[model samples]
Every structure is written in C-alpha cells, then in structure tokens.
Target chain A: MRDAFHDELNALNDRLMQMTNLVRSAISRATTALLDADLQLAESVISQDAEVNRLYAEIETSIYELMATQQPVAVDLRTAITALRMGADLERMGDLAEHVAKIARMRHPVSAIPVEVRDTIVEMGQIAERLVTKTGSCIATRDVDLAKELEDDDDAMDRLHRRLFRVLLSKDWPHGIEPAVDITLIGRYYERYADHAVRVARDVVYLVTGSREFDDSAS
Target chain B: MRDAFHDELNALNDRLMQMTNLVRSAISRATTALLDADLQLAESVISQDAEVNRLYAEIETSIYELMATQQPVAVDLRTAITALRMGADLERMGDLAEHVAKIARMRHPVSAIPVEVRDTIVEMGQIAERLVTKTGSCIATRDVDLAKELEDDDDAMDRLHRRLFRVLLSKDWPHGIEPAVDITLIGRYYERYADHAVRVARDVVYLVTGSREFDDSAS
Candidate 1:
C-alpha cells in the first residue's frame, strides 16, 4: 500500500510537469499570436486550453483520491494539498494564456500590441516563459531554494510591468485609449502569469518547509 | 470521531462565512472610498485585509488538518476539499477588494472613478455585494439553484464591464488616458470580485451535485 501511494504521488508529479509544459506552450504561442497578429496560432492556443483544464481536473481528482484513500500524514499530506493548490495555479496560468490568445484573436490581422511597446511585451513574455520553466523544475525536485529563486525572477517581471505602466502614463505615449487599454491588459496578463508561476513555486516551498512566510498577499 | 469531524466541518463553514462577510465589506467600503474619495475608509479597508488573510490561513490550515487526520471519503472528502478551494476564492476576493482600496488611496483626495462613469462603477459594486451575499448563503445551505443564479448576477457585471469598455472606446470619452486606465482597472477589480463569488457559488453547486459542468474556465 505504501508503494502504491508513492506510485500515485509520482504520477501526480508527472501530471504537474505536463501541466507546466502546456502552460509554457500556451503563453509562448499566445505571445507570438499577440506579436505577429497570427490568428491561427491564437486559435490553436485557445483550443488547447481545454487540454490544460482537463489535466487540471485530473490532477485535482487524483489528489483528493490520494488523500482520502491513503490518508497521507505529515510531509506526505502537505505534498498532496500543495499539489491541489499548484494544480489550480497552473490552471489559472493556462487561463491567463487563453485570455492573451483571445486578445490576439480579437485583433486579428492587426497586432494587439503597439509597435512602440512591442519590445517590452516581448520581453515580458520571455520572462514569463522562463519563470514557468524554472517553476516546473522546482516542483519536480521539491527544491525549496529554487522555489525561493522564483520570487526573485518574478521581481523582474514586476519591474517590467511597472515600466509598461510608466510608458503608458508618459506624455509621449502616442497610442490612444484603445491600444493603451489593450497593452495595459496584455502587460497585466504576462505579469499575472508570472505571479501564478511564482505562486506555484511558493506552494512547493511551503510543502517543503511547512512555512507560510513566503505567501504573497493572496492568490 | 465522526461527530468530531462534522463539528470541525461546521467550524470551517463558519469561518468561510466570516471570510465572505469580510470580503463583502471590503468591496463595499472600497467602492465608497473610490466614489467619495474617502481616504480614511480606503485605509481602513486596506488594513483590514490582513484580518481576511488571517482567517483564510486559519481556515486553510484547519482544512488540511481535518483531511489528514480524518481522511474523509465520498461527500465528506468532497466537502473538505471544496472548503479549501472556497477559502482561496474568498481570500482572492478580499485581495481584489484591497487592490481597489489601494487604488483609491493612491488617488486619494481625488476620486478614482470620474463623474462620467461613477454610476456604472457604483452599480457594479452593488452587484458584487449582492452576489457575495447570496454566495455566502448558498455556501451555508449548499443551494445549487441559488448557486446557479450567481452566474446571472455575474452576467450583469459582465455587461457593465463591457459597457465601461464601450465608454472608454467611444469617441465621446472626454476623460484622458489616466482616468481611463484607472476606470478600466477598477472595473476589472469589481468584475473579478464577482467572478470569484460566482466561482465559490459554483463550488457549492459542485459539492451538492457532484458535477464539474460548471467549472468556469479556471480558478
């Protein structure tokens, strides 16, 4: 029974890694879709979110089942509960990706991002992608130090987010309200995507350390 | 043992109700702060969010303890896990409210919502308050029908959100980019607050019906 439970735990970890990959792809493609004005890629990213959600549900159900059946205690119980929260975080990251894709699809044939701020959005996307990739490894290894490192990585994204705001609020921002709003939301999407990845890493940290000091505000 | 577990579950429910009240008050007061330019009220709302987070952490820890010790199955297991998710939803709702308050405080001595769109924001806040109130009750009673009704309440919010966008996009938007951006984010805070309320209510629906049909994209 112990071995079986360990097997199930391993399976849960594998599924979480799969989810991380899916979310990374979604954000990467969605960024391309937003930058290139590629409707086909946007549509694909939007459609693929269902798969992410499916995996989320699978992981969630499995976590609950593991808890109910195995009654894991101590570190094992923490691991199970953290997986549940991480699944939700990953699922939300996927939704943020979808929102980005929807924005791309909404402005088809025309990029959602203005050329002036395109570079910042591109960099934000790259940072988001890198953060999620690091988060996947952190979860896989249960490395608390790596998990803590994600917070610093998230700082870069937050800095970029603030810079986007500065550009928007600047007098030279030639983009009118429409594009400004779009860019504002798009920047938010990337910023929040990184936030969620950081959140997942934080949960991994809590799972390892049994501490809540790293909890960021809320969700 | 079973009775003790049920008692713990009831306590969890009570805590969740308390969280809903805190979140509702936060949004309501934050709206007033935004509309009235009430810096004191905004500060109060922002500071009080710590209490909401405290309750969230308390409830979360309790749920994990219950699950690990009791190892509830079937409906019991579902109830525990759902409570955990609902706690997160409520906590996030509080954070959204706090964000609104911070915005109000940041622009203090001046209202965040311009006079042109003030009424719309006021209505959105009212809808958010009503939705959370109903959500609290639905959670208390596990009323699936009432839970379904929240989606409609959220629809009203969505419509208002879109209307705000139309006004922003309209040729008659006299407010410049700063106020436009402020209004946009404020609208989103309320809209997302409502979305979390709907999510909690939907979780109640799922708890009672054992259905995942109403999973709203992601948490």
Candidate 2:
C-alpha cells in the first residue's frame, strides 16, 4: 500500500509538472500576444484555458481520493495536501495568464500600450515565468533551498513592480489614461502570478520542514 | 480530545468573527474616507492593520498546533483546515481595506473624483461590507444557505465593478490619468474582497456538502 501510495504521489507530481509547463507556455504566449498585439496567440490562450481548468478539477479529485483511500499520515499527508494547494495555485496562475490574454485581445490591431510599457510587460512575463519554472522544479525534487530562492525572486519582482508603477506615474508618460489602466492591470496580474508561485514554493518548504516557517511575512 | 478540539475550534471561530468585523468596518471607513476625502479614517485603518495581522498569526499558530496534536480526520480535519484558510482570507480582506485606506492617504484632500465614480465606489463599499458581514455570520453559524447568498452578493459586486470600468472608459470622461489609476486600483481591491468572500462561502459549502466543488465552474 505504501509503495502504491508512492506511485500515486509521483503521478500527482507529474500532473502538476505538466500543468506548470502548460501555464508557463500560456504566460509566454500571452505575453507575446500582448507585446506584438497578436490576435491569434491571444485567442489561443483563451481557448486553452478550458483545458487548464479541467486539469485543475481532475487533480483536485485525485488528491482527495488519495487522502481518503490512503489515510496518509506524516510526510505522506503533507505531500498530498501540498499537491492540492499547488493545484489551486497553478490554476490561478493559469487564470492570470488568461487575463493577460484577454487584455491582449482587447488591444487587438492597435496597441494600447506604449513601447516602454510593452518592455515592462515583457520583463514581468519573464520574471513570472521564472518563478513558475522554479516552483515546478522544486515540486519535482522537494528542494527546500530552491523554494527559498524562489521566495527571494519574489522580492525582486516586488521591486520591479514598484518601479513599473513609478514609471506609470512619471510626468512624461505618453498615450494617457488607457495605457495607465492597462499597465496597472498588467502589473497586478504579474504580481498575482508571482504570488501563487511563492505559495507553491512555500508549500514545498512546509512539506519538507514540517513547520509553518513562512506565511504572510513572505509576501 | 474531540470535545476540547471543538471548544478550541469555537474559540478560533470567535476570533475570526471579530477580525471579520474589524475588516468590514475598515472597508466601510476606507470607502467613506475615499468619498468624503477623510484622511484621518484612512490613517486609522492603516494603523489598525497590525492588529489584524497579529490576530491572523495567532489563529494560524493555533490551527497548526491543533493539527499537529490531534491529527484530526475527516470533518474535524476539514473544519480546522477551513479555519486556517478563513483566517487567511480575512487577513487579506483587512489588507485590502488597508490598501483602500492608503489610497485615501495618497489622495489626501482626496482627488476630486466625479460624482458618478463616487457613487459607484460608495456602492462597492456597501456591497463589500455586506459580504463581510454575511460571511462572518456564515462562519459563526455554519450557515451554508447564507453563505450561498453572500456568493450572490459577490456577483452584484462584479456587476458594479464592470459598470465602474465602463464609465471610466466612456469617451466623455474628463479626468486625466491619476484618477484613472486610483479608480483602477480601487476596483481591484474591491474585486479581491469579493473573491475572498466567495472563497469563504465555498468553504462553507464544502463543509456542509462534504464535497469538493471547484469555484471555476460555479462562479
């Protein structure tokens, strides 16, 4: 039974890795669409959201079944619970990507953002992608050190986020209020993505450390 | 042990209800300050945030201890887990109120938003406060039906949010970018508050139904 549970756990992690990779691609494609005003990629992200949502449901059911049937205790319990929380985080990350894609579609033929804003958006995408990648890797290896590094990465994202806002508020901003709104919402989406990534990392840490070492303080 | 666990659970719920009330009042005061340009109220909300954070930590530690000691299963496990998640949702709600309050301070002698925008903000506040109140009641009584009603209230908040954005985007808007940024962030804070309320309601539904229902489809 324990060996079977181990296999089930590995299967769960595999599903999570797949979801993380898909969400990363969605984020990348969504950013590309936003930066280039590519309607096709934007539409693709939106259409792909259903698959992400379905995966979320499937993972939720599987995790619950594992818990119920295995009655897992100790490390096994932690692993199952972490998987459940990570699934939610990944799903929300997907939702954030979908949101960015929707914004991309809204921009359509004419870009609402200035070139500077586009640059910030792309950097935000890269940072978010890195966080998501780290989260997936940490889950695969149960690397607490990697999880801690992801926590630090979020601090840098926070600094960049603040800088992005400062640029928005600068006196020389071009294209007026619409760009400001776009930039603000875009910053929020990236910040949220980073947040969920941090959450996944923290769950990894908790699974290994057996301590609630980080919480709101990490944010 | 089970009886003691229930007592501790009740105490935790009581603390949570108190926090919810504080957050609800904070949101109300913050919104009032926003509309009335009352800087003092915003300042008070910001200062009071530490208390909320402290209570959150205390509740979290209590939940952790319970889980570590009791090794609770099934309904007891769900209840404790739900309490911890509820504390988190409430803490974020407090933080949102703090953000709104900060916005109030940012616009000290608050920026003169148009009457239409002010009305929408006021309405948004009312909805947020009601959701807080109803969700708190749901927690205290374990009333799933009332929790469902709060979910409906969240839908109302969404509608108001969309309407506010539409008004902001309307061609005749006279305001430039600053008010636009403020409105955009304020909308996000309210939207997040609604999201948390919906989360609390979903947890209640799960407790009542003992079923894993995903928010993606229901919402």
lDDT of 1 by residue, B93-173 (tens): 998999899899999899888877888998999999999999999988888989889989999999999999998999888
**Residue A4 CA displacement from its true place in model 2, Å:** 3.0
CA lDDT of each prediction against the hidden true structure: 0.89, 0.83
Candidate 2 deviant stretches above 4 angstroms:
A212-219, B111-114, B212-219
How high is the lDDT of residue B204 in model 2?
Answer: 75
lDDT of 2 by residue, B1-219 (tens): 988999998898889888988898899998888888898888999999889899998997787677667767777877877777778788888988998888888888944356768888888999999999888888888887887787688889999999888888888878877788889989989988888877877787787788655454422
lDDT string for model 2 (A107-219, tens) is 89866557766676777888888999999899889898898898778987898788888888878877777778888898888898899889988888888887765666533
Question: What are the RMSD figures for all models against the true structure?
Answer: 1.4, 2.5
TM-score of each: 0.97, 0.91
Task: State model 1's lDDT.
Answer: 0.89
